[model samples]
Target: MPKWTAADVPNQDGRTAVITGANTGIGFEAAKVLAARGATVVLGVRDTAKGSAAAAQIVAASPGADVRVQRLDLTSLDSIRAAADAIRADFASIDLLINNAGVMYTPKQTTADGFELQFGTNHLGHFALTGLLLDMLLPVPDSRVVTISSVGHRMQAAIHFDDLNWEKSYSRVGAYGQSKLANLMFTYELQRRLSGKGKTIAVAAHPGGSRTDLMRNSPLAFRLAYKVIGRLITQAPSEGALPTLRAATDPNVLGGQYYGPSGLGESRGAPVLVKSSAQSHDVAIQRRLWTASEELTGVKFPV
Candidate 1:
């Protein structure tokens, strides 16, 4: 059991990967590495212009790298459907799907589909995308789905099945925490369902504290706090991307494994096998969340 690093990522030739929010931050770094390693990387983003620019950057960095950009607004089901349809039409199969797009603390809002913004974009959007793409995923042996969660999940209360939308009471931090927790729960349960199938693996990773634009839309106080304190805590976006890269490419990684920074408080270091909170491992809650997610998204796992 050697600790893994980017060097451990085997050559990814002939593989295809779709990474959400690859236009910037940890997603961008991960995409760049995977494409450089010879995987066909699709940048799933809302802004075509930015996505194109990011793809260009990757191609420039890794000459002859096969990379493209696709439109995907996680906040909208229509966008998710369109992206899936386009990918299915163009590619024979997909090797990896990284649910890496996310939003941090922000003022209360709603997605295009009317769910709370954080939960909708961060958790439900990826949930729907993963479900919709299950057919393609299942047919590809060794395929993987990696969900990105966070340590903030430990600070928040458990999922409020009664009011998942935060209709009763809303708090930005709490919503973000809940959404992150949902990501881990989704990852573990997906692994449980896919167990013994031998076709696909579901895993989760977190960047710890990364200096990315994910917090750009945060409220003033939050922004100021990061401005003053981020230097002491956060790692660079490239450094932050290690856990995701490890999960995506490490051959030794097991299904349902969660990876994160190995430094103090899991904030910054080489990617390492990390433990999720006790609540995140509760099967009953994960099952309920899975059912609720399927019902809410109107998309069932094809497994």
Candidate 2:
């Protein structure tokens, strides 16, 4: 099969897309492409100022791009609820919910709700947000929920059921891995539930070492090394966003499928169907994570 690129993204005229952390990087790139393709794109950002700026940039570039901003700080449940409520009131139905916001390897910290920062923002926040907005997408034909995972999921990832929050011990790398793994599991479990239902589907994708600001929080040594070698290895944010755009807009993509770079080590090339870690496919763990998420966030999926 030929390689999939953003050029393959179907026309999104009359579609409404909600993307989180779209102020910059691959998220911003994805939002820009969708807006250019005629989707009314809503930037769900922690900083409305940044979101507005991003929307303005898109408008400047696309001429008639319809883009808006919503305040969404994934670290707080209240913020998530408020953002969802605002989106619900303004939009009658959503055609896409792109769970693209995330945090990388940061020092041990917790969210406003006391959960680990990476897991809370990367996995749990998106989980809650998807549950809240899924109703709108449920009835729309070909609507999709696309979540962004990462290659890091394969690096020291395991669901620490004993300490899901990493209270007993803390390894930033392990925490990030756990959260990313949760992303894939969430997509798989959601696909299972949405199967044979309406047109809504759940898909996941990774940027594959894309050059983005997400790695700003990594260790200084890694950051310094990346500065020297990143240009040689990592793809641009536009290139990285292709996997996500393909997952969100590719008509042939099925629910529960994943996409990533097609080059060496799946790190830097055009987007293509990709495989996740074996652990991410564990159905039992997926259900358990779902239940735990619902209990933690007080959000339930209607599906």
Candidate 3:
């Protein structure tokens, strides 16, 4: 198989994309490349200032780049709704919706909506966002919903329906894992709903051990390891964005499939078709999560 890189990203001319957390790290890298390839990219972010700066950088790198910014704080439902409405107003047909923004192992906290921080922002937030804007994607041929998961989905990952918010007990790593696992489950359920539609698909991806500020919330020992050995081993943000880009635009990609690194242990390498945890493929859990998410977020998909 050939090594896949940003260079392999097919032409995105005339495509419209909305990327969450597009101001930095993996999102920024994906936005930059997409914009360079002629897509009208919107940097959906919580900070408009940082988002504008990122848009400026992209335009500078690729003169004539059609790039802009929008406010999107996934921790707040209002912010996500406003962002989706604004983007929908601008583009009736969306080619790609990259649900990429997320939080890692943070000190226990809840979102503005009162759900646990990681599960809320990483899963429910994107769930609501996708539900709100799915109409814009359904009619567009080859449209895709690419939600970013993580290698962590295989590490300590489980959906605790009894205490989804982790209000009873909290473990930072465990919460993060649950959130990422929900991402995969959501994609599978979404694809099932999208089946036979032919025009739209739901896909997932994970950046294998990339060096990004997302790890700032990790414990002291893990942080120290990233500062030393992890730094030497992890892939770059551009490389980390590969799996996402492939999932978003790869012509051969199927709905319900996942993408990650091709290297050993899937830690770092070019993007390739990957498998998520078996728990992530549980249909009952996926259906349960989909229904619970709709109830929690008050957002329903057009499908």
Candidate 4:
């Protein structure tokens, strides 16, 4: 059996990929590969200047690459809507929408819409963006909505229905867990809804233990520990992006399937089909989360 690599990505001519937080790390790596393969890549970023810089980098690497940038601040609903509208105005149909941007452990904070920063940016924001743009995808055969989850999802994670905002208490670790878990549940529920609609499928992937700027928000003690042992356990961003690339482009990928590193503890290595926590497969909870997310974000799916 062969391992999947970026080289395995098929020719993507005429495809349009909108990737969130694509200015750096795994998202950037995925964008570069897809662009090189002839996809018109859109870097959806919070900072337009940074987004343009990232797009320039991609075009520089892949000469003649048709790369564009759209300002997308996931922490705010207005920005998400604006980004979606801008994208729909430019491209009539979208082939891929990769929910790749996220925030890691940070001191307790809230989003522009008053939701917890991690949950709002990581799960709810993508939820709204996807719902807004799914209409364009439904009309295009084989279109995909690939979301980026994390191995952290299984680390004491649950959908905190009672205190979804963590207003009672706050543990950066637990909040992050809730958000990532929501990412998986979202994918499963979305796949169920997309069923019998069209060729569009919902998929999830995780960049198992990659060294990136995502950890900039980590506590000093944890950051110090990572600085000491990170190299031994973590893979590069390019390596981390492999699972997402495979999830987005592999023709054999089925809806609701997950991909992650094949190495020990799924920390680092080539991308392959992987299992998520059993809790992530809870259909009732998934439906509940979907309904809750709709209520929280005021975004309903057309599917």
Best-fitting candidate, scored by TM-score: 4
lDDT of 2 by residue, 31-108 (tens): 999999999999999988888899999999999999999999999999999999999999999999999999999899
Question: Per-residue CA lDDT of candidate 4, range 1-303, in tens?
Answer: 888889899999999999999999999999999999999999999999999999999999999999999999999999999999999899999999999999999789999999999999999999999999999999787899999999999987999999999899998989999999999999999999999988799999999999899899988998999999999989999999999999999999999999999999999999999999999999999999999999999999998
Better of 2 and 4 by TM-score: 4
Best model per lDDT: 4
lDDT of all the models against the reference? 0.92, 0.94, 0.93, 0.95
TM-scores across all candidates? 0.97, 0.98, 0.98, 0.99
Instruction: Compare candidates 2 and 4 on lDDT and give the better one.
Output: 4
Model 3 misplaced stretches (Cα beyond 4 Å): none
Model 1: residues >4 Å from true position, as ranges?
Answer: 1-3, 219-221
Q: Write the per-residue lDDT of candidate 3 for residues 1-303, one digit (tens) a residue.
A: 778888888999999999999999999999999999999999999999999999999999999999989999999999888888898788878999999999999999999999999999999999999999888888889999999999899778899999999999999999999999999999999999999865899999999999899989999999888878886669999999999999998899999999999888888999999988889989999999999999999998888
The segments of candidate 2 whose C-alpha lies over 4 angstroms from its true place after superposition are none
Q: Tell me which residue pairs clash in candidate 3.
A: none
